[model samples]
Target: MSVDNRRVDASPSPAAPPPPDPGAAYAPGPARPPGPASRLRRFATPVGILAGVVGAFGYVATFDPNEPGHYPVCPLLGLTGVYCPGCGGLRSAYAFAHGDIGTAFGANAVAVVGYFLFAAVWVLWMVRAGRGKPLRIGLAPVYWWGIGALLLIFSVVRNLPFGSALAP
Candidate 1:
């Protein structure tokens, strides 16, 4: 032959796969049905979180935040004499735990609203976990910004004389 110009392909064909072993006795099947233990396992995280929250509320309820030298003062309030959104959060929690709803709102209306929001979210999380679905709180950036603006407004209002009722 004068010249050989043909190119040879090196790659394996896509349709080809390694042959299965005939000697194997067992093959993987579909997933097994969830048992009582499995269902309980799914709820472990939500229950643990609830336990932690309950413990924290219990501690706050036991040790009054309104009393002097009980809890740490908010650094922003201590330094600038200006209230932050979370300034009275502990006190609010204490009041809420004690079933003093009005006092809780008086301490921090935003914090009281936040407590209820957290409870709602926690319930949703628990329900989704029970259903084997992931909890999705996909808030838009605008919503987050709006929340921040609201907190800023709350902080500013609580500091003003007219909004003194919002202060702790």
Candidate 2:
């Protein structure tokens, strides 16, 4: 018997179907075409958010929360005889809007931090929106729990005699 040494699998295979064109995905496939409004639509949400924020801050800046009958008392504080995390949020906002950082912090240090945090996140959201990218706040469960715990601690601490400094 003669032994054959030739390789059986060296034959050229069909050129892989031209790689699904990378640009094909972007090609307007004769379907609904993009228009000027589509570009503007991307900005609508972010701009609306900013406008609402500005409007709210404007109201807070104009109307004093410290004034009687302007804002309602916090229900939790009213009923529970304890300071809730948001007990003085409006006062903090009012103080912050008027550039009284010290009073804002005195009212609610956590709320002051929240104000700065919101500002930072809003700036980031605007930048992403302007770039046509989605602004996602995908915090993990752990982060959420940490925030809850921090608030809980703040609530408890403020109600204690030692934490009067944190009271609204």
Candidate 3:
């Protein structure tokens, strides 16, 4: 009996694709133009957000947060006498709704800034939706940290004597 010395290949066929590159960025394929219904659907989220904000502002405007029993006091302020970042935000909103921008800022400067920031972002979102593009706010970690630091500073300052101007 003669012994055969030929080896058989068990590896994948040469036609098979190579593994994808993990570091490669994803590129979307060509997109079709949005129709009327598609445009309406895209705009829905921003519109809904606007409606909710308007409703909330309307309610705050109607009920004065400065008056007792109108709105609940901030638990942190009520308990420990420390003003959180959100303290007096309701009064700020209420003043803003009534077109009292100066009073609104006096109530909570941070909240006023946030309100304007939200409005700007909402406008951008609407514009992107109209153009059939997704609104992507890809803020870096540094930006998030900066925002946290700002809120912390605001909260700390508002509670101090020097920051009495910032307090409600």
Best by TM-score: 3
lDDT of each: 0.90, 0.86, 0.92
Model 3 lDDT tens row, 9-117: 8986779666778999776878789555587799999999999999999999999998899778888998999999998899999999999999999999999999999
Error of 3 at 87 (Å): 0.7
Query: Which of candidates 2 and 3 reaches a greater TM-score?
Result: 3
Q: What TM-score should be assigned to candidate 3?
A: 0.78
- Itemize residue pairs with steric clashes in candidate 1: none
- The order by descending lDDT is 3, 1, 2
Q: Please provide, for model 1 over 34-91, each residue's C-alpha lDDT reduced to its tens digit, 9 standing for 90 to 100.
A: 6555778779988999999999999999999878999888898889888999988998
By the lDDT metric, which is better: model 2 or model 3?
A: 3
Give the backbone clash total of model 1: 0
Every model: Cα RMSD to truth: 10.5, 10.4, 10.1
TM-scores of the models, in the order given = 0.77, 0.75, 0.78
Best of the candidates, lDDT: 3
Query: Residue by residue across 15-129, what tens digits does model 2's lDDT show?
Result: 8766676665565557875554465787788778878978998998899888989988888878979899988888888988889999999999998998789789888977877
Count of backbone collisions in candidate 2: 0
In candidate 3, position 81 carries an lDDT of: 93
lDDT of 1 at 47: 91
